[model samples]
Structures are given as C-alpha cells and as structure tokens.
Target: MKYLADVTTIEYNADKCTGCGRCIEVCPHGVFDMNGKKAFITDKDLCMECGACANNCEFEAISVDYGVGCAAAVINSMISGGEPACGCSGDDGGSSSGACC
Candidate 1:
C-alpha cells in the first residue's frame, strides 16, 4: 500500500526499550531487527507503517505518527474533518485490520 506520506520513519527511544522481541515478532513487514539487545528499525522504507512493533512493545520505545499507511484512513479523515476511525488511529490500536474483525 503506497502512502501519500511515508510513515516508515520510525522513532526509537533507546532509554525506553527493554530489549523485548515482541515488536520484532509481531511486525508483518519485518521493520525491526535486534541490535545487540534492543530492537532497531532495520528497514524503514519497507515498513508498512503497521504499528505492530509499537503496540507489542511493552516499554514504549517505538513510535510512529501513522499506522498501516492506509490511504483509506487519510481519505476518511480528509472527508470527515477528523481523524479516521479504522482502529489504528495513532498509538492506541492494533497495526492490522484483523484487530477490527
């Protein structure tokens, strides 16, 4: 899914990471790879903006503004005048649509 604004530029706060592999395990796009002990954004552009890494991270080390890079959500927000409600609005929902189902 091509996004208007690539949301793959992930922000990692090393201080917050606990070296947990949950993010790595859950990410469908394989955005993260373990570096020593902590997780790192190995492939930023390849990231689907899926927040699986962020959601699964207990330490809150990973964060991104958009999730899943869904054009539907952006279009919905543009037409509705508010943030889209496709579940992955920001930092509070699953990265996949499967969560909605």
Candidate 2:
C-alpha cells in the first residue's frame, strides 16, 4: 500500500546527480524520471525503502531516513519485541521500532 502523502524520506541532490539514469533504471516503482538531463522524483511515496535506488546511485544524490518497510523486518521486530528497522538496523543500534510511516 501507499505510505502517507509527502512523508518520503528520499532526497535527491541535483548537483550530485550526473543524470546517469541509474536511479531511473534501478527503481522498480518508477519513483524517478528524467527531467531533461536531471533526475526528478516523480512519486516519492512509491518508495518502499528497499535502498535499490540509493545503492545503484554512484553519485550518492539520493538520501533516505531508512525505515522498516519489509514484511520480514516487521515480523522479525514483532518476534524480537524490538523496533523494526531498515534492513541496515540503523546506526543507533535499532532502538526505535517505527515503520516507514
């Protein structure tokens, strides 16, 4: 399902973006589009926090807050009685169990 409107944590830096289209090619949800030579965020909410775009972006133009949005993460958090986290587990040691919401 779609997340809350305008709640996207993805940030795109035009200066850092080389218009290489890597983000466009890697994003499964079509969250990005080509605006001439620049990349644009067409549907930020479509992001599932999978980190695919960020991982594929060599320029590091995309930044996200990183939240738990996967079913495995949610189930693991519930079973562990801990805050669900992005697959990365956060830098703070997974103290907060909030979803991508």
Candidate 3:
C-alpha cells in the first residue's frame, strides 16, 4: 500500500552524519543512500514523512516534518476504535506494523 507522498520536508545534512547508517536502516522508502562514508537523500519524494529515519538518527543528521501521516493514523484509530497499522499486509494477510507507518 502506497501512501500519498507529495513533496516532503525530509532533509539530509551529510556534515552531521556520523556514518552510522542509522538513516539507511530506518527509511521504509529507501529514501537515503550511502555515499561512501555519509548518507544522502536518494529520493525525497519516496519519503512519507513518517519520521522513522529522523526518530532513529541519534546524530540529528536527518530531519523530516513529523506529526502527520502516522500520527493522523493514531488519532484516527483512536476515534474509530481501531489499531494503528503500517497498512502492509503480512504473509498471513494482516497488518504487519502497529507503528512506524
């Protein structure tokens, strides 16, 4: 399931990257790619602004406009008496993640 990703606010400051590859590890959309020792934004539009990469980066190298998308899902789930999910169907045909959408 693809989220309606528009122009994202995701930004990558390579100078701040510690070469830990944390951003590379957490981006669900493969938005970040390693340029040898540092990471750069390979595709900004691929980002859903889920904040997963930003949340995991201890070095503060990656930044995204958070508190939307998944946050909206959380609020909607609460209002609708449902659970927050990533919308990815598991092998058993169920939601795979309750967080990090």
**Worst 10-residue lDDT window, candidate 3:** 88-97
The whole-model lDDT of each prediction reads: 0.68, 0.79, 0.73
- Model 3 CA lDDT for position 27: 79
Specify the highest-lDDT model's number. Answer: 2
Q: TM-score per candidate, in order? A: 0.67, 0.67, 0.62
Q: Which ten residues in a row have the lowest lDDT in candidate 1?
A: 92-101
- Model 3: per-residue Cα lDDT over 15-99, one tens digit each: 8998888888887788888888988887677788789999999998888876445654565566656665544344543432454
Error of 3 at 42 (Å): 0.7
Q: Candidate 1, TM-score vs. the true structure? A: 0.67
lDDT per residue for candidate 1 within 27-50, as digits (tens), equals 877777889987787667776656
Candidate 2, position 97, lDDT:
50
Candidate 2 residue pairs in clash (backbone atoms < 3 Å): 83-97, 84-97
Can you tell me which runs of candidate 3 are displaced by over 4 Å?
1-6, 70-101
Cα deviation in Å at residue 17, candidate 1?
1.6
